[model samples]
Target: MAYECLFTSPRCVFFTFTLLNQLLPSILGATYHSHDVTSDTVCNRYHKRELQVYMSDPVILETRPESAHMLTLGLSLSCTFEMEAKGFYTTGVVSVVQSMNFRSHGDNCLDYMQTIYEDEDNDMKLKRKKSKKKKILKKVVKAAVLSRRRRDTDDEDGRGPRICGRVLFGLQVDENETLPPPFADPLPPTKPDQGVLSSLFWDAPNPYQSLVSDAAEVDHKGEIKTRLHISNRMLRQNEDVNLKVVYTAYQECDGRRVPESLFHCGYGLCISRSLVNDGLVNCPFGDCADEVDCASAKEANIIAKVLHYERTDETSVWWIILWVLVGLVLMFLACCGGIFLFMRRRKH
Candidate 1:
């Protein structure tokens, strides 16, 4: 037996021919493939538009050089993301990782230890003097008590000649009081061993530090900013260091399921490509309006104004000083001339 089937849709048409049920599986497979292709095409267009929004404004990462003799401190790594004026970034995570070779041993410690020792010694001396005074006061109090008791017993109030309390109490009297133990000498600072310094300072050859921004969100026209601090203990001089930043953005589509591949603005907001540079904030949170976008142009304008004012101020200061000096010289010359004229007139 032979059978024929026809299927029609606005965008798709399918025709099938089968002998009994032998061709049924092939027909079903063809329909399934067509559906999948249509779905993929739609998803691709959506993904491309979403990526354009994210890539419109680039993220910036910057680092400052840190220097230290024995310890390097405050090596700062900054991550700046330019947000659209009206756009917002939904909940996202930003991670900053820094890796470098740090040395555990350095010769500068010798100089550093000298200054430390001087301060420690001065403090110890002051403490020792204070302790000595306290001990002397304790000794004086004990001596005075013993002398008063001896004199009081000598008066013997008719009680079969009162004996000295010291003898009655069977207490041995020492002519001199024993002093309290002296303070122990401060231990000298020891030099760290070069061979084992690395082991003692760090556990790994290349140490890496990471800063993560959890629950990070940017409002419409706001910035996503974070700073990573690399301490001197983690950095060494003349070592190559690398820094990396990773960010994941969240988007909201008003309850529509966003494809996993599409980039989104935070707080369930969808970002549009036309929003970039449109000067209108679209992100519900206003995370897009911060200075990250158009930072170069804004910074240039600021720098120009600052430089102009600085130069003008400098020039004005010099001019004022010059005029003051000239007036002083003129005044001195006039005074000298008047004195000379007065002397001549007096002689005449």
Candidate 2:
């Protein structure tokens, strides 16, 4: 079925990623519990018609040298619930990990062999060149790889993950099928490593390694959910890539057991505390309610006080120095006048 975009015009871009256990840990206070997928039914909408969510895996796109940076994967699915929203809402989050592996190019032996073939008359010289070239190539490779590893390690440690582009894809459930209020999904953390030298010369980190803490939860009753982990590694141009897609229907939670770290978004939705003041709009209504009146004001006040203290201290020191200099000059002038008078009296 043709899935139409809920936020904007429909586009035929598909992405596949694994849906994690509990999307919003802070919003849902209770420990994450997976639900039976057999009992729950998840459906997607196209042209106001309901259809089952289908999967098209391993979609390959060959990226050329000039246009690799501009490529983005977007998937829009309008999920329509089979049941009514009984004082609860459903949200789904998919985590994607993209890894690029660099293949070493230009074999030194092959280039040397080609050079030897060109100069067929120099048999003795070819043997000497071959022996010298092998030793030089090994040293060059070792030095380059070592330098690259050091640089890559420093870069990873010094800086946080770089976000290349914003990802905007979420479920747009109809009011009849879901809740009345429309909730906004906060931007999840993404890792976009676009290092040419590091990927080429050094081994990349394991993509499957979880950066988050190890916290697992069992399936709770009245909740239908599934957990999946996907690793997207070694992305290259003209390569047939297969993305593993795992499906997990969202769980319905009563608003009774709300966590202390959650911020209410007007009528129904609860946003995580970490998502607040993150400089992104997490609510559909009002001008970024979560970001408004954040700790930035307090920080700015503290900074202003520090600057004021520094300025006051500097001004006070300058005034004290000026006064001391003035007093010393006055004392020296008085001493000179007294000496002049004494000399005049003695001369008289």
Candidate 3:
């Protein structure tokens, strides 16, 4: 009966983790629910492709690595993406990985992990999870057993489960797999001062100024969609003599931490500055006299537009004051009526 009631109630019925339980108190109105992520992670263009990529490879950053975008496991990778979204993570030597399309799957996972510790009992914490489903545990053991036999058979007809960590042969390979140093990943050889760019790309709190080694820059207009750093209003209004732009990278495990090492983003030790003002990218490719001089009224209109604000907040404190006054008046009337009734009872 209890089990039947659980399913009947909306609280217990959830697709992934998008559940609202009547019996449980949610933290800050945020409910922890499991979401299925697969099809939602990648586009349909990669439907037929199978990719063989190395395990433990860093996700490529520049040009948006295919591995970074797609969500898959060995079985899920084999099958077409079945769901809209999901929240599965992988464990690595230096990082735990999370990937998704529209939403922040990483922080959602981290927040869920934090909820586990809220119990205050240390024993209740999660150990590393090994299996994605009930059945995979058996396949993993079988694969291990097969791996041992591969040494004797010459790996031709009947060796074992040939599960290359990424995928099988002729599968879609994401070229943006990040290979780091010690294995000859193409990066500018690091000098003593070369460590500066590390902070910029990693989770360093501030941007590194005075870059000497990395000078080449890519100022993209409407090309780069994922904005790394957003400038504060103070930086824009203060009009500092020179404001520096800091480009940052999100950690695969958590968006907060500075990655110990980053995968391929094309150039290593590249000093990058975030471009904010349109003026920085407004270099018109033309002749000498054709350029409109910005020293006139046209420049004034441009300046005016920058300073102009189109929207105004509608709320005002006067409404609150009026409501409070009405509440006090009603309370006073109730008190006077109570006193009159008490006097009439005493007289009677």
Candidate 4:
């Protein structure tokens, strides 16, 4: 079916006109023969008159580069048959791409033409770039899948065998960027041959002693041991912005939980039912306020923690000086210990 165009449609006119040169960017010249220059021309020779804009611009025209803030208008040259709305009856319609350049010799023409040219050129460039990126991503995904399949077949390559495919077209053909290393075999999944006690730390007197950890699967009475690990994360963030005053006229309870404190106290109001009988907590506090069967304490502690745990007292800190001193002392002792062991071995 043949599609018809109105006088207002500049795009249809440009598209119709540019198809003449076997798909090349249009050049500025009068000799260019196009399908658009038929019985209707921009300059009417027979009537000896300037073209009449029979009506307002076309009803719909797409602006290039959707996010383009500036409007780039394309001009089309065409003659009309029957100009409706303005009411004129003509025999034919002209469809040709028209340029806005006025001067002939210098850059004024070049600059105007360049503006239109570059806009279209850049639009095509961006489209090509997006298509290229999508292709690269698809290739990467395919390579990964192929690599996984290859690895599943071969174990001799401790590092999994690489899967490779050619990138059909690329900006840098010879630039060899290697694929990322394959995923490492996860430490035989660390089945945890022995369990660790979070609350009770190992304090060994022997420097070379491998710390022994004993976890009872069953209690002394032979009852089934149900130990739940309760992880309590503490974040004591103090806001300097008098934020409490900003949020409300009076001050509220800032959340400050000491896991070690709770452990030291042994019993407290349950902040979370998850921690009720939970045997383990990742972060332990030194001491916590003892629960006196107080109803409000549970509510108060919860509100404080959720709002933001801000402790009035010192919590966890890694002291640089303390660690340095400890390290130096340990080094000196280690040297002495090594000397003693060597002397004993020599005597034997």
Candidate with the greatest lDDT versus the true structure: 2
Q: Model 1: per-residue lDDT, tens digit, 182-206?
A: 2244212221122332333211111
Q: What is the TM-score of each candidate against the true structure?
A: 0.20, 0.18, 0.13, 0.15
Error of 4 at 192 (Å): 26
Per-residue lDDT of 236 in model 2:
48
All models: lDDT?
Answer: 0.26, 0.26, 0.22, 0.21
Encode model 3's per-residue lDDT on 170-268: one tens digit a residue: 111133422221213332323123234233221111111111111111111101111111112222232221111111221122213324432222222
Better of 2 and 4 by lDDT: 2
Ranked by TM-score, the better of candidates 2 and 3 is: 2
After the best TM-score superposition of candidate 4, give how far the Cα of residue 82 lies from its true spot, in angstroms: 76
Clashing pairs in 2: 34-219
Error of 1 at 182 (Å): 66
lDDT of 2 at 249: 20
Best by TM-score: 1
35-142: candidate 4 lDDT, tens digit per residue: 111222211324321222111111101112331221122222222111111112211111111111111223211111100001123765566567664555545543
**Per-residue lDDT tens digits of candidate 2, residues 178-234?**
312222553222232424533432123311122211111111111112221111233
The TM-score that candidate 2 achieves is 0.18
